[model samples]
Target: MKPSNTIKELLDILNSNRIGGVPVVDDKGQLVGMVSDGDVLRYLAPKPLGIAGLVYIIEEQ
Candidate 1:
């Protein structure tokens, strides 16, 4: 699929469905990347990648 797909369309399909993120795939359904609400928000946020803020990753004990 292409990025030209609207967020509204994605949300409509995502509703009543359970998945972590939307797999951005080529026409053959091969995954290119994923797009979750979290992914979108992160990109929109005022922070650089791999930088820590209110959220941080913790190694499992």
Candidate 2:
């Protein structure tokens, strides 16, 4: 997978391939790193103070 690929794209690949993770590559196709399902979930998960941050943002808006 490329670094610029979206989460949906990666998830699709993982699901279709029945894999747990994927290797992230650059434009040149060199392996840069790997991303697992856990990593993606963690990234998408809410932060500890997410509600407070959302409240502040709503008030600001």
Measured by lDDT, the strongest candidate is: 2
lDDT digits (tens) for residues 1-61 of candidate 1: 3566786576665654765467788777788887886765565564664645424421210
lDDT of each: 0.61, 0.79
- Return the TM-score for candidate 1, rounded to 2 decimals: 0.50
Off by over 4 Å in 1: 43-61
Give per-candidate clash totals.
Answer: 0, 0
Off by over 4 Å in 2: 46-61
| Tens digits of lDDT, candidate 2, 1-61 | 9999988898899889999999999988899999998676666555654667656643652
Clashing pairs in 2: none
